[model samples]
Target chain A: MGLHFTNGYVRKKRLQIILLQMQHIIALTVLFHHSYQSKGEHLRMTNHSAPTLNELVSGVVDRLKSAGPLYYLLLLITLSLVIASAVIGLLAMFRGHEHYYNVTREIPWGILISTYVFFVVTSTGLCLVSSIGHVFGVQDFMPIAKRSVFLSIATILSGFFVIAFEIKIPWRMAIYNVISPNLTSNIWWMGTLYGVYLAFMFAEYLFLLMNKHNPAVICGFSGSVAGILAHSNLGAVFGLLMGRPYWQGPYMPIYFIASAMMTGCAVIIMFHILGYKINGEKMDGDMERALEVTTKVGIMLICVILFFTTWKLIAGAAGQPNGAYPVVMSEVAGHHAFSFWFWEILLGMVGPLVLFILSKGRNLKIMLIASISMIIGIFVMRFNLVYLGQSLPVYYDLGVNEFKEMLTYSPSIYEIIIAAGGFGMTAFFFLLGEKVFDGHKVEHH
Target chain B: MNKMDFNKLQNEGVENVPMQQRRDFLKMGLAITGIFAGGTLLSAASTFNKAQAADFAKKYPYSPHYSMVMRQDRCIDCERCMEACVATNHVPNVHGAYRTTILEKDTSDAIGSTKEFIPVLCNQCNLPQCTRVCPTKATYKDKTTGIVMMDIKKCIGCLTCQEGCPYNARYFNEEKKAVDKCNFCIDTRLARGEKDTACAHACPAGVRVFGDLSRQDSEVFKTVHQIEKAVWVLRPEAGTRPNVFYTKG
Candidate 1:
């Protein structure tokens, strides 16, 4: 009887151990599922909802049941596409086959390059804005400071995503940049500086979160200085190109900084308003102060932007030794005239500037409208900066047979889908943050 | 009662303190004030010294280095440079890309004398503004070659260089995520031990010439030295001190 009892007891113990191990495994799987689903599903769902401007501005989370399954399906499709793209890229590299999308001598830059710049610029702006509260002691900006830091980090990750997709040989770029850094190269400096800046920002934020014994004042100050330098360096990347007429200018650095400030402010304001709506929290004094400060900054930035535009046009109007005035005149009056005058100037600049001025930085309704307009306007500005700058010919007087035709660029569907995927990724990360971390914590009144 | 007696005795003894003690406290106060004032003066002087040491002129220029020297008399508005650039750079043949092209302006008759060709490129200059504003040091002048070469690998593609170059020489390559312009074909020619640039070599009429100004015996050096009368660089007002010289034929 004792022998039988011992056998039974051992069997029971073994069963218990197996059950415990199974539970632990299940728990880990659940964690993984949540992480993946948060980014994958939420992103797809948000895209599919075709969330209206109102929905976006209001921060409405769509009903999950209907959108959830579709999102999963979309996620699966996106994953497949990503895999296919990777495989194709690898095949091209290994087999030495020419990919159709490969930028040739005529069009050396394309959608991938443009997208990469967009993400990097946005990330730089985000980082700078986040640093303002901690570094500059901008008391009003404190409430959103942590959130801004998180967003900046997230944006930087997004930048990496676009760049990874853009480069034919990303590994080569990474290795070459470290080993064979050309000191005179603007691109090298930009990459190196931003890389360092990202590290610093991450460290600063981590220190803030960990409640480390380091002096907060010193950390903040150093981070701010680094952020400004990084952001300005990003602008210098374009400004340093004396060869590219459109990008060569002293005002570009100033313009870049101002615009970054504007965008950063807009993003914070929009996010704050959205967070408030989602959490059903009343707008507090700190939030109000943050909005007010951002509004004033945004308005001032607009004025600066106008000054830049006016001066650029006036200079271009003046005749050049090479009689280059026609190029400028055509830009102002020719085929690209619509984008320059309307999309860039009207929608991006004038529209937002007018809104901000009329709102007087007081009314939330007006501020909301102005913020949305500014964001859209900024996108237009980026597009113009990227596309218009490239639209001009480099050498005008080659032989008749050798005369190059006008350049053309239209983002392929794959490119557009990938861009959409980026947006999805952003939305997914944001929602996950809200869900897991309770990121929408209300500031004390 | 005994404690009260002692306290009263101590209180009575307070009058026995020295008057010099009061003067000592006052002297200490004055000494501190004097030290503070002296420190302030010292700090101010040091700040001024640092400011004097800073040479703002040598640091960076706020404007383009080379300005266009328009010789209106010689302009014939052939627009050859514009066409050639489009072909070479593969500039979108669309309306926007005209780095160097002709602009039509009627002298007397709106229809007849309406065009003039003006070749525009980076006016290599003494005080290139693009180099100064580059925060990342992405844009730099070659000490040996005197050519401003942009390394795309380092470029963050901010487009500030375009605004700084007065000649509108800088073009942002949307595809490359960097600025592109007439490097005088530095990557292809000068860097590869060639004598001249694609633009200079391609110009059939000898409208453009490329040579190192560093070599005193070079043709460019002798030409600038001999024909000092009519030779002018573009936009002398920009303070760029352009290397390219233009003469109305």
Candidate 2:
């Protein structure tokens, strides 16, 4: 009815008026900002300081000053652990994988694979979580984008370190995976996409470092897409196995992405708070608010994954389908029951959910305790996911003599050392990141 | 071989067969297989269920279409086939390095008292999960023979293929530093002009019958198509559509 009454001249005049109004609004905003800038008291009250170069340099120097004896001792220990893990990994590589590792023909994967999954899942989660702030322009998530991006790179690097030992000839893999590309292979896609994802992540991090907001946002978007693709492919690696019915469904790929986000939130809060403690600095107001929102997000995802786990258990145990039944039982009441119940269910899901609630997204101590517990619990969760799916014999229906029951695998000494070394790599790089990257401090867009 | 004999054989209840005769049949090395499949049994001459069995060779993508039919009831745990495979393939004599092995199953419910010995090897599936999961193309199906072969040099020993296989057929060969499974002795024997696999030749109970499925007249094809036997495969639900068939003669 409104359109029918208006003439072309009238519409044109109205459009011209809107354009003038938009310009007036922009001019008024600029004038307001300029007036605010002139008031030093107002600027100080708002805490939006564009520090001079001298002030910036002094601030960085101040941040680099020694914190305490305990901090130095922690750094020294983590670095030593990293060095020891690298040396052991190299020695095992030279000696041959089959000789040193407990991985056999039956149980071909071990703790190393699970630990790699744990680290990389956290990386993908961090990328996805940070993209909410940096790419999607969510104000509450802004403070974490820089720190999470740096930690994502560190965590993925740690993942690669552990996988280097698991993959017997990584150099050969580097050559063949490119020259002889298997388009249909899930592993090929996971590896290749992760490589692209890493490149994008590095570019995204570099852009963030240079304070190029637009370019950093674009890179973060690209990195998120790549991370989702790569992370889902990693899940497909387990899901696509026709023999492993426990993991042979959409549940794995879907569960992985959800779990990654959960892990991302956990690691982000844990490390950021820990980083603050290590530097003897407290979380400022904005950063504290960001963690509060992130904690709420963590609670939501914890519930999502808890739902996934419940369904996984229910479906796996119902019929005792060839490969799924025994695995579910093992996790529920069998040998892995303690780890599953105590670590995966109680500590990983319930404890964090409860603590996040009690903290109300503000209590640093409770949040810190919850985050640390969730990290350990989530590591065990990854281990169970990888191991339980394989613990059931492939030929369970065949009813063979040797495979009358479930198979068992315990991490060997070398595997344990390599896994510890992987953790050390994360710690070492994380400590260095805090110092070298100037505590990852910067203003959000 | 004729319709009259077939009719008479059907009229005689399967349970009427003398225990001594059955024992003698196994002893005389004619125990082709009890031909148990999906919990049903059939006699020797009628290896295939005529009404149900069809020419599945239409699905074969290779020229030679190499296949094996296991006469399951005939396997008596002699392990001669296992020895022959190791000797022929130069397979490492280790716990998990076998190219083939025998399995013992308790069939006490069905067979009254005797435990059944089953022979298992690489099915060389029409859609081999092992070949599909190998990131480096270290393990692959042959273009001409349909035999699942391996290029040990390309194997990175990730063991992903071993995990992908539903049958637990493939294993890491520590000697070769690669994943290895039954290739039907293609390189060691078949390429050198041998007509059959080492296990087929050494089977004292005629437990293994290996031949080309592409040739309708081949022993493997006839044994699979004779229509009287309920011929089937192990783990048919896996959807691998293996070239191997198992039946009791």
Candidate 3:
């Protein structure tokens, strides 16, 4: 909340503040180690004897110091962005959202909702992908499980960060969501389940860190189940709406689950490789094999999505249906044509598929490129999905002047900044996690 | 009129033509059962049923069952009703944020009016999606009158209710920091013993007739039950089972 300093002041004091923070962390770690060690407090004792709290803290500080200048620069940039966004979000709350946000009465949702969806989708995908290897005992998937689980937590937290600003009365939501719950509302289900899923994931991560394999596996399984349910309910939030025909029916829930898996595969492959790069470690045979299988899964899911898209387009376009026809036409040959073809279809799906095939799941570089492309494409895909559904006015069929044409909306500066902050939060947490967790190394059971 | 040349008849668009007028045209010795192929072809097999008692409610569930019936052809876009609603409801002066508004349709080729104006408002449906889909019970239907009411304190302003509403009636009130919609003046005048809503009271052309539909003698119930004119609700396909009805005299 103290992100209100002037730009010049921030520029001058940034280095000094970072250094001071580091010294404080080191001092705190030393004090903790002395106090605990003097008492001979054994928090948990395992056969491997996982690193103690003090050791983890000291090690993280050392890693932060030893990390390349690029890492520090990236961390600094992301942290500043997060601070700036926090300032803007707080401003929107007091100053009224109309001045800062572009959302109108006609179009109440905008980029923030889409970004939230994108983050949660990535989170769910990560959970599912990691569960296959760790919880289900798949040997190939085992290597990437720890890192994916950590990233899943990071991504979902980012999602919560973005949506908290979007919901106008967030404090009320937090209170009423527990005390006065609505059983019929999909949003209530999604929010509650995601909360449960986050708890399970945190417990699982702690268990994994403590080298308590059985507890970790149980938590991982529960997290995955909760993740799938929460993710599908999010889909149903849009899908079950009878008014928005473009998103109506059983299609969304099914598409969401499949798409989350696909996204999971892409994110897992990308982050695992990036994790090694940050740690300056070479990919072991096991990790490489894990990525290969992940790639194979990605390819299969891509095909599945293509099949789904083809039919979705046909269902919308064929015979020029009542509610869906105009929306589909707009996407195909109207305002959203370029976004659909280039981003959602080409970069999101086709480009990644081609690159992954070329990599043969062996070339981490090509795989990384493919994953990056897919990530950008998926972000756009999510934006399009949220925006396009609201494009057609509810009274478009009546042929009135106001409701006859498609409504257009674009994110304002504040919205874009807040959205970027969600990204920054994920990146910041990720960089911090890698160093703190020692690249999330998995000790084979 | 046997084996009539259908192509010779001028195609009057259905937008301005009431169902009763079309039914009358069918009764001109044509005995048409239904319009098919997107209203291009007429088929006759005696599918016409005068009474819609089954489709219409036989028993009213709510005691007061507050409802409105619009005489569609009578609306002349005076916009007096809108002004009255704004004044009565404390509606903010902003674009696309209104408790009630009029929609104008260009019916250039109709047999009657070249253009038509229809008043629109929250239907206060029997099965309101806004209340059903609300994450909290911020918006709900009144048990006594079936008027959809809002608890401003409970509203989180997620705007999911706005998205869920098929009628485009709900809007977020910036001042209240909550989603607001028409509650049939329940808080304003109805609780003060006013019989009619502000819009209905202000209309000069007798377009809006507001009454409790539970009583058979009430204007709304009489209008809705009469077979002499076809009464309908907008977007019937949405299946909200609305409390509001529209008819043309």
Candidate 4:
């Protein structure tokens, strides 16, 4: 009876081992099948004309079929806003700027300027962030390069769109910017260099599409150099203001670059994740690594910006410099207090920083929440920076009736519509990018 | 313990200088400091000028070298000067859009009883931030007259000049689609071989003294150069080195 029981136990053990081995073989077969299918798809792509018109149409149709009511609603809203902006901008263009914009001699720049700054800054940040991978050959950052570069172009174009309405004679600018360049003027340099940056970026993206590695690298490096110059010059527009004590310093340029990096990281993470969801694809291991690295970089830049903001507040508060003090005080304890505390300090900086750390760069949902909050916060940050600097009267110390306290500037409907159009342009282009670029899929390296 | 004279103080290593000598020293120190700063104040705007020597004199390098000195105490709120400026220069009638304006200071406590009117126009700073910042040389300092002038045709209406000006001197001209400021009536009157600006000529109270600083005999030169009556400029800390000087009657 004991010998019979031992033989039965041995037979059962052999059966369990056979089942385990079968499970391993099945897993290997599935892996091989996935690779073979992917290889087949790649060959198909390589043989065809790169994204031919037929492919584009089919790809777009596929996206349209996947798109829900929410997508249509977003598109409708975007189109309506853009149309409204166009009507108002044309009216102002034909008539006079005074008819549409509420900008006065006291406060020349309004919401449109802020919106333009926000978009371009984001674009510049994306370019820089992507350059870290493409130009400098950082492995972890490589996965995001194509999407980042594409988005950068979209955002900067949006910036140009908003600013076109703001500028009284944009046509004149196009002519004069080329024919009559002012080297000393930061605005001129910024405008010209931004043009150059756009050219390089366009070439880089085309090279990326064609898979021309060396040319893409060259264009990317040149684009980075141009972007840095243009971005710093943009900062210098405010910094070099000798009269505006609030904006008069080297701090603006430095803060702008750091803030750009922070913005770039937030935007890349947010959009890349969204891109994945829209495409109905899971984040693979490499993409996950890329996001983790981005989160790390975001953490570092957030600290840099935090340090910058702290110093800005302390310095602006200290001894109360004439033009700077009133605006600073308002931001701290007056009208801007709510925006400063809730948006800039909490959502823009602290919340994102903490959330990112907690996420361990793995929790997508948490990171998404942080990214969305940050995007909103950063928008307000730009508005605050532009408005606050100009909010206080240029002659605040004069104690005159015209400039007894701070100046007020609320965006008119026209201004708001035009600014919103910038967002519409960005969204439209982004959707188009997703469809046309096939989710900006990085080729296997 | 410290009543030593200059000679005695010099022998005593200047540590024991008398209080009277210290007062003289203060004056001397101020004069020396002024000499160094005066060059910068006077030469700041000339640096932007393509046609100019490095050694720009305290007096401007223009032919007429137009300058204005305001007798601050004599101004009244009659605004006849503004009216005349508008009539002569075709300044549009609008709110906060003036080539020149009057700023009233209620100094009832500081002075004995009443408010004072400050008639202000472009100082045409030696280092004109407006000109330097203008992407298109729409606003420029005149090489011939040292007057800050504008080419309205070239303006893109960026408003950078308005931002750059220390004084609230520039305003966007709606009709012209360009920034307009006090060019000392250069386009309207000064170009027509007028001796003084429209405002200067039209002042009922002789409050404005307009003249060429390059000529030593001019009233503006005398008033600005001599420090006897404590002549000053508004927001001197801005370091604009304004061509406009303000003095109390």
In CAPRI terms, model 1 is classed as: incorrect
**How big is the positional error of residue A365 in model 3, measured in Å on the Cα after superposition?**
1.3
> TM-score, B chain, candidate 1?
0.60
Error of 4 at A81 (Å): 1.8
DockQ of each: 0.03, 0.51, 0.60, 0.43
Using DockQ as the measure, what is the rank order of every candidate, best first?
3, 2, 4, 1
Where does candidate 4 stray beyond 4 Å? A1-44, A47-56, B1-59
Estimate every model's Cα lDDT from 0 to 1. 0.56, 0.82, 0.85, 0.81
For candidate 4, the per-residue lDDT at B160 reads: 84
Counting only residues 3 or more apart in sequence or on different chains, how many pairs clash (N, Cα, C under 3 Å) in candidate 1? 66
lDDT of 4 by residue, B117-185 (tens): 788888888888888888878888888877888888778878888888888899888888888888888
Which 10 residues in a row give candidate 1 chain A its minimum summed lDDT?
A30-39
Chain A vs native chain A, TM-score per candidate: 0.74, 0.86, 0.90, 0.88
Deviation in angstroms for A254 in model 1?
Answer: 1.6
Which scores greater on DockQ, model 1 or model 3?
3
- Candidate structures ordered by lDDT, highest first: 3, 2, 4, 1
lDDT score for residue A21 of model 4? 78
**Candidate of highest TM-score:** 3
Q: How do the residues A102-214 of candidate 4 rate in per-residue lDDT, one tens digit apiece?
A: 88888899999999999999999999998899889998889998889999999999999999888887887887777777778898998899999999999898787766779
RMSD of each: 26.4, 14.1, 7.6, 16.5
Task: Please give the C-alpha DockQ score of model 4.
Answer: 0.43
